[model samples]
Target: MIQPHQHADQACSECTQRLGLIESGLRGVTPVRFNAAGWYRGELRREILRLRLNQDVSVLKAITFALQRTLPAKALLVPIPSWKTQKRANPLPALICRSLGRTTKTLLKRCRPTVGQHHLSRRQRLVNMKSAFAIHPDQQSWCVSATPTWIVDDILTSGATAQEALHTLKRAGLEVRGLICLGRTP
Candidate 1:
């Protein structure tokens, strides 16, 4: 069973509430804004273990529950890559995707470096993140047969990042099933 302390003792109200929503019906999924709304505040980060705990467990549980009932077929969990790997330690999307994956670890990779999407304007964000992601050539064997994937992320703002990831995966002949995020700005 999943343990709460496995992540951290602190759980934000947003995380709790989100878990509830995802548990109910899998709709009303929103992205958690770490920058603008300061959702990624140091305290929240520490509490949520800097998103290391599968802080979005609620979200993953929802996806798992749905997939178990609807699409029993195997699925791939692909995450948008982080530009800098040394700092953050681990990519939250990739981590979350691994938590949800049934048959594999993760297939998405960032082949190119891009600037932070937060500082850029909508247009800039799109341009900056373009071609930022690619399926690891080494993992082609796994993805070649895996149809329909879930592009996982911590949040969904303009959807540019996830869209770019989808575009790259599709070019590699992988079918994207849907996009899953912890929260979204509605």
Candidate 2:
């Protein structure tokens, strides 16, 4: 339903159950719109896909507007690295970061290419994403703080990607507070 605002707690367990995550909670007010039918139905999926693949910002304004309003005031936003190795010419996390810079900023970068998770099992997804991210050298300072970060991604499925990202950040001494996504796989 995308609530206009949601509060950030010190932490939450629901995400732990759903994503096997530690050191993070789910973002506020945003709902999973990817389904057979509903608010984020057909056209929305196509638009999101378009934006993800082509960097089309034409349809993401509403999501960005909601994100700007709902993001926690105290934390920075760490976008989960995009999958495209060629260059993130377009992708959801990149697009969101462009609009979310005020309440949050990015500190992680994909250090390597990852195998796509589309056809993988949970175990495979976890293995595939292991060590897939690295904190930027210049952003190393951001990793030093116990200050929480909201790990943003385009979707939540098995959560392997977010879990891996969280672990990578933790490995670098960064603290992750939550997972923010545009949708949840249905």
Candidate 3:
């Protein structure tokens, strides 16, 4: 029974710095606070991310509702693809994108599989995500949009995945605004 926070919505500066985005970058609007090493809160975070129950979806929707107001009007939401190549291997990011009520696109795909980032060090995570994403061939023509693009995901940890996503989209000539996620590890 995780409830929404009552404080003003603000981007985590630490997360932005960790993500290595430029100053005043339009990324890192995480409303949910996650403690990866905690027992109770960590379990709650995992359950909501797993999306196995209606309660989990409800919680995510509430989080996204708060996040939506922070985004620029008509910004494009690009979900970071899962390390697994299968179409639905990881659905949380896309689900969050859709929940934001923006123009959601699966424009990126995993170029190659990589190990999970949970147990990896920051440097290890970066190495694992190197060149992991590429523009989806079918979505090539959609890259010419003038709308600001934001990478959407369930959580922001080492930010390796988001960095890779930003690079891939930028290489394809898309204006990647920044990243928006449901939660950030504290």
Clashes of each: 5, 1, 0
lDDT of 1 by residue, 3-27 (tens): 2323443224455443432332244
TM-score of 3: 0.73
Distance from true location, Cα of 113 in model 2, Å: 2.9
1 or 3, greater by lDDT: 3
**Which residue runs does candidate 3 get wrong by more than 4 Å?**
2-47, 50-57, 85-88
Q: Candidate 1: which stretches are off by over 4 Å?
A: 1-73, 87-90
Candidate 2 per-residue C-alpha lDDT over 102-177 given as tens digits, one digit per residue, 9 for 90 to 100: 4455677777778778899988987888878777788777778877677877767777888777777788887676
Better of 1 and 3 by TM-score: 3
Model 1, residue 5: what's the lDDT? 29
Query: Model 2 compared with the native: what TM-score?
Result: 0.68
Tens digit per residue, CA lDDT, model 3, 1-186: 444435423224443233332333234333212111111235435654556334355445544554676678788989887776565466777777766678888899888989988799999999998999989999999899888888877667777887888888988899987777655665
Estimate the lDDT of model 2: 0.58
Candidate 3: worst-modelled 10 consecutive residues by lDDT: 31-40
Alpha carbon deviation, residue 28, candidate 3 (Å): 4.7
